[model samples]
Target: MTWVGPSACTLPTVEQPLRVAEFDALFAGAVQGVAPPGPRN
Candidate 1:
């Protein structure tokens, strides 16, 4: 499924819900005390 060059390539949608447990563990382990990126003004 290559989006080859020529006309501007349309990127496919990645419509998967990420697994929360994996991200939760990673966030707790490596990202504690770090504020997430602030909302856009």
Candidate 2:
């Protein structure tokens, strides 16, 4: 969760919910190029 970006004054504010969700999914190890976790038998 280390957001290394420019200062608030340097960047414009905009809502990017999708991008956030995408990154969250990636960081949470849920959007990799492999089969997702399945239920146990």
The candidate 2 region of ten consecutive residues with least summed lDDT is 4-13
Q: Candidate 2, 28: how far from true, in Å?
A: 0.1
Model 1: weakest 10-residue lDDT segment is 9-18
lDDT, candidate 2, 10-37, per-residue tens:
4344544455666788878864476779
> Top model by TM-score, which number?
2
Cα lDDT of candidate 1 equals 0.49
Give all candidates' CA lDDT scores.
Answer: 0.49, 0.59
TM-score of model 2 vs. true structure? 0.36
Candidate 2, after superposition: displacement of residue 37 in Å? 30
